[model samples]
Target: MAEVNYKQDMPPKGGYAPIVFQNIPVKKYFNGYTMFAGFAAITSFSFYMYYQNFKRRRLLKIERQDAINALEPILLAERDRSYLKQLRRNVEEEAELMKNVPGWEVGTYYGEPIYKTVPKEKLLDPILEEYYAHTSEKAYDDKANEFLWR
Candidate 1:
């Protein structure tokens, strides 16, 4: 009887080499103008947005003031003296409160006031008061009706 030996599992027959791996470092390339162009674009966009905001806010403020001016005479005539007086006080208080706020000058590049340097004491100025006082009954009626519809 012959005994079969399976000790080394057929052993190594040839010179077998292992696979070698090489790592190559890749260098990143960028254009010189790319960074500057990006910065310029961001700065320009930011400036444009700020300018637009200033213009819009200034326009809104003017529109609001104009509307209030237009309605002043009618409201004063229709409402009682006490109520008008109270309303004037409230408006002045609000203006004072908003005076110190940032962007108070809104669109002014030099931070100057829209109108005069000094603020008006009352919402209804002497001009409007005089206009209402001197207006005839027919003209007053016509103006009041026009304002009401507007």
Candidate 2:
């Protein structure tokens, strides 16, 4: 509880410390033009970003509308065709169930085993193997199998 000497730590001649930039005294004053320029820049940037976002959304909406308009008819036609195909399939399935075809038992089994199964030695021929591989991977053949009897 002795008296605290606060005067000794302070500069001998001090009211407030002067701000110096590279040894030059900086005047403490607000530059209205600089503040205004900064505010304008920030506001303008925000507005520009908002405008770009709006423009992008509008363009995407237009593109989506265009795609829907263009593909709507084709999609409708495909839907109708698929429905007809399904109906035909249901009818055929019902008939097959009633008649109970000898070789058409319902099971997880795929198409019949290859009767003319190629020998392992035959697969060693590069030309024959390549041809068989190409035929096995044929897109049209795969798709055709979906609608045709094996």
Candidate 3:
């Protein structure tokens, strides 16, 4: 690598030489107060950046703590909750509601459910249509008969 000399070799200040406006060296031309202000600015910027990072992490930790607190209720509420007991209660209630329905009893069928009669008209039964509406994906089916009561 070639090194370019940027400094001018000069004689020492052994002889009294008249100092003119442009005759001063680079050091003599520097403003100490301005350099000190620049150092202060750099130091302040570094401190500001460090404080911002610390604040961001602190905020994240607080948000995580809030999330944990919010989820505490659901977690603690299940301490004595029995899923099987609730399921049994729901089944008993459902049985009670269907007990008095004329000619309708708690029954299950194998494979796809088959209706006693085919629907002869559009939107004939709301109950059967509602069941299909909730169960079927209701997308990409070109024929409404896929869910028709038949």
Candidate 4:
């Protein structure tokens, strides 16, 4: 083996350049004005959408209310007709039930008035059992059985 001489490498005069240990800050893509503008645009768009939804809901509610108002008189008239029909049926039933009894008026007991506070006394709705008292037992049972099956 031949003898060889090698020179050792030395650092620069300022010692060595400082190592980049910390992260370097990058340039901002959006400035303050741009950020504010984006926020304002998004906020305005959201507000506009909210306002449109609210207006649509309000219009729908008004339309529903108008429909209900328009049908109110017809519904009331139907309810009144049904009430009168039921009243008449109740009167007929009372008359039929009291036909055999002596001194038993439909609205009075032993010729005495049942109600004196009002000029015309309102008949009470009959109970379910009492209303169907005269009906055949088989018919009532059949109706109940049919309802249960359905």
Clashes of each: 0, 0, 0, 0
Cα-based lDDT at residue 14, candidate 4: 80
What's the CA RMSD for each of the models?
A: 22.8, 18.0, 18.9, 13.4
Model 2 agreement with the true structure over 6-61: per-residue lDDT tens digits: 75577656576776657766896659998899999999999999999999999999
lDDT of 3 at 55: 100
Q: Go through the candidates in order and give each one's C-alpha lDDT.
A: 0.66, 0.62, 0.61, 0.80
Between candidates 2 and 3, the lDDT winner: 2
Q: Give the Å error, residue 21, model 3.
A: 29
TM-score for model 4? 0.54
Candidate 3, residues 1-150: lDDT per residue as tens digits?
998979897888886687677755555654889889999999999999999999999999999999999999997777436433443454466567677666554322232224546543322323433323323356224335556755
Highest TM-score: which candidate? 4
| Lowest lDDT 10-residue stretch of candidate 4 | 126-135
Candidate number of the best lDDT: 4
**Candidate 1's error at 111, in angstroms?**
62
User: What lDDT is obtained when candidate 3 is compared to the true structure?
Assistant: 0.61
Tens-digit lDDT track of model 1 for 51-150: 9999999999999999999999988887667546645564565567568787664323246744565464534343443344433677557865786877
Q: Which residue pairs show backbone clashes in model 3?
A: none
Total backbone clashes of candidate 1, pairs 3 or more residues apart or in separate chains: 0
Report how far off residue 105 is in candidate 1 (Å).
57
Worst 10 residues of 2 by lDDT: 123-132
Model 1 has an lDDT value of 0.66
Ranking by lDDT: 4, 1, 2, 3
Itemize residue pairs with steric clashes in candidate 1. Answer: none
lDDT of model 3 at residue 5? 78
